[model samples]
Target: MVSTIGRSFNFQPCFLFNSKTVDKSLTARGHSWLWPTAAGVGATAPDRQIRAAAEQRPTWLPGLDPPTYLDGTLAGDYGFDPLGLGEDPESLKWYVQAELVHARFAMLGVLGILVTDLLRVAGISKIPVWFEAGAVKYELANTGTLVIVQLLLMGFAETKRYMDFINPGSQAKDGSFFGLEASLEGLEPGYPGGPLLNPLGLARDIKSAHDWKLKEIKNGRLAMVAILGIFIQASVTHVGPIDNLVEHLSNPWHKTIIQTLASSSS
Candidate 1:
């Protein structure tokens, strides 16, 4: 009777050795067989939903087109025009170049100071070996001061430019809380100091600006971070506490790179 039952069922001793009939039998059980399929669908659904949400995410500040840089060129075309002393499209290109130059000089000045401090701590007094310690110190001090001033100026100018761009039609309306429409309770959309100053619009612009800044940092400014990282690493290795906060604030990849290079060379 057992042999007849076995013959009727085509049973395999191990799951690994199960035949098509067993699989078919399992599928015939319905809910139990569908569990894994359901689980897989459930697992993938969230990811698909997330992607769809990202795709559908609305962008504010719709009309602004921020300049992009590639290979030290504005939109991969224009060259150096640091003073913005050009005409039309050239003026726009020069603005980008000037911004880049300003950033570069600022980074250079900061790195120079940090590196010099590191060198001094390491008993390497002067960089050239010919210049007096006093002279090198004086040079660095003056240069750092000048660069810092330039950086501050550039920052102020850039902020003004950005503010103008974001609130082109009416700066007073968009940025300030207490604008002309703020007094009017019945002000409608598309009017100056009306919907522009409303919570939703302000939130959208703020979010857009935040995203734009993030994109700028992620894309064009990595080299600045990396160059600054070298200074941080040098300070950490030799000078100690001075760059500790900077090292902590900066990404771990820089530290990893510095350590790996040190190890490989040693």
Candidate 2:
């Protein structure tokens, strides 16, 4: 009887060792065999299948694979090409540059609007409302000539930028005219870094440059949204964003966007 007990104990330990080895192998393959109950089995199959599936899942949209083009090379790319606009490589490059340009413009626009409104609020009566600035009467006698000259200058600059984008490194950087270089040697497509751009050397290294690019894209996106909101608010209320904020602050209950719209409709 003592001999039989010793054999049984040895067999039990060997069986447990094999079971543990099998569990480890399964776990390594993204599976579990610990739970053997009916409910556990029902849950395990789906979970295990998902784990066994391809790893390249979409970040924004669940259960879908990310686009082939969105390999996370761009600064702010999150595989967000729902419309498949950037499927083509060349088109994707152009869109990336275009987005950067638009974002910069949007940031500038939001800054201008907010600053103008804040100045007006601070009793700067000379500063006209941003939306109404176009309609404000100018004191200049030759306004048409000024507009024409401005348009010509802006058109020339924009055309040069566009041509450079189409054929990068084509623009001369001899800096012959007033220390002006149309394109820099080591800058990105839209970013024509010269003595005037980022002169502080904020992005000195590769990692810092990438970090700055990410920050710029994020802030630019937020600025674009803010500018859109400002336009919508201006169109709806016929007032500046700061005025709207002041009204809301003064009377939170009734000065809200929804309440204002309801009252206007009523």
Best-matching candidate per TM-score: 2
| Cα-based TM-score, every candidate | 0.25, 0.73
Residue 4 in candidate 1, Cα distance off native in Å: 61
Candidate 2 residue lDDT tens string, 175-263: 52344664243365676665467576556454448778989999999998999999988888888998999999999987898997887
Best by lDDT: 2
Query: What is each predicted model's overall lDDT from 0 to 1?
Result: 0.42, 0.68
lDDT of 2 at 89: 86
For candidate 1, write residues 1-266 as lDDT tens digits: 00111112212133455345444555445523332322233235775564344334322222221122211222222222233233255455445545554555556655665676567546776353211333454544586786798899988746644554445434345434345435322221122223533545432343235454344333435546655665555544543323444564576766554674585568
Number of backbone collisions per candidate, in order? 0, 0
Count of backbone collisions in candidate 2: 0
Instruction: Give me candidate 2's TM-score against the actual structure.
Output: 0.73
Q: Candidate 1 local accuracy as lDDT? A: 0.42
